[model samples]
Target: MKTQKLKFTFLVFIFSFSNLFSQYTEIINSNNPGFSESPYSVGSGVYQFESSFFLKNLSTNTPTSLDNSWGVDLAFRTSFFLERLEFDAALTFQRDRLLGNFTNAYTINSGLSKIMVGAKYLIFESTYKDKSKEIRSWKRRFAFDTKRLIPSIAVFAGVNTDFVSDVYKTNTVSPRIGILLQNELSNYFNVITNFFYDFIGTNFSEYQLTITGTYNFNDRWSWFLENQTIFQQNQTNTSFAGGLAFLFNKDLQINTSARFLREAGNNGSYITLGLSYRINRHVDSYKLLDENGNEIIDTPINRYNNKRKGFFNRIFSIFKKKNKGNKTRNRGKRKRNN
Candidate 1:
């Protein structure tokens, strides 16, 4: 009887918090902010950093009380050679606290949850310069509305290792792969989809699908909604998150979000805060410089070319050529006079 009341209360709690659940920064292109991953890379030689704190509360259909857990996640990604390929790494620390009625509250578990390292490669991106000519403006430029066309596609793969203890880790490595698709729906809206398969080192593999939609309020603010589904052989799980992002600047952003987990045995909600930063790469275009800081040439070979010519020797050679030309003209004139 009490279990039924608890279940009803849990439903009420989830619905009540629905509006507050949606929010996070749009800077990170991975699953941290939401379920969907962007098809675009961070560009070549660029570095991106993101850190998030998540607190989740679970309300099971028990007679007494709820379970609580929380985690801190940190992720970093960078482009090595080109904008098409980038590598990512992440670590998560989690704690679970479970308490029972008439019993003391105690820490059930605490440790490193997981570590992941992966890479993504951009396979195809549509050119949108022609389409953007009409609507391009300084405002749009600052808004980061660079999505070009339909079906920007990328492939990503990663391995996740579960930490067992300080000296030990999981013997089996779990590998995952996914395809990310992104499209610009309108001037202010974008959608991203990810289809993933995880090899759980078992006979059966897990499949996941995540879709996210984002709306740009302006250059500095955006909102997002995400839905994610995971399928296994025996059971399935679905989750939803909505969040808003505040871009402090082009390079830094902060986000707040809430997530709801819908499952039979374990129903919970997650509240998260995150921030991301982009470090721009340095690109040098000038190859040669003269004394007064004037650019002499645009290619690196200018240094070798200058080394072959001595200053006074070059001057003397020019004068010698002029003198030889005059002597030839005089000889020709004398012959004509004779």
Candidate 2:
């Protein structure tokens, strides 16, 4: 009888603890589960910085007593454009820290939160002029840029090295491909669908999909909504986020938002604030200014813009010339004037 009772007790303990067995949870949540925000939409040759504190890993079903582990990400985005073609790269530095129970917390550091480089191509662009001309009103313009709907689809593929924690089972280089589909439904609103799939699979294959939207109340103020669902071959969670976006100026933006997460019978909420500077890689900022201690590239806007103009002007000149009604006369006038 004693032995049988002991075995029964052990089985009970295992059953109760099994729900707490979580493999891993996403360390980052600034954008949708699958997609990251663009530096262009945020600003131009800028650094993107995000800091977050997570109450729980939400990896499993353990109930948290209170405030817990946290994470941070610092990143940069730079781009050069030639006519309608844009070449951009995003580099991110990541750190994630995990703390055991707050009372007796022992910090366990895992693989790099994020170490990845992504290349992007802009498939569509709409100008302030086009947007303003159509919307017509400083008030409307203040509400937002009279921009064109990208009605665009862009592709991104990158290799990331995640220094997974020794505590967890995953250890590998994660390669991923993503599709960003964006459309401006109106002068004040835009919707985007982010789809991403990781080639490398954890115990469960990794898949994420998010539907996000931004509504501009004015050029400087906007409302943003995001719904992201993350699925592993074995487990899954659905998260929702909403927040306000403030454009401080033409080149800088501060995005402050809130995120709410739900997993099985567990639920939690938190706030996030992000700042970014956009980089237009037209000029040689290396010569004009010194690099930030951690920056991968150095360059400024106006010069970079001009450099891109020269390149695109060459590649797309044929189409540009055809659009110019007085091309021959303009050429002759320039020649004669010179």
Which pairs in model 1 have colliding backbones?
22-242, 22-243, 23-242, 23-243, 23-244, 24-243, 24-244
lDDT of 1 by residue, 157-193 (tens): 9987765444325567789889999887676888889
**Each candidate: what lDDT?**
0.72, 0.52
Residue 235 Cα positional deviation in candidate 2, in Å, after optimal superposition: 1.7
Indicate the residue-level lDDT of 22 in model 2. Answer: 16
lDDT of 1 at 181: 90
Best by lDDT: 1
The C-alpha TM-scores of every prediction are 0.67, 0.55
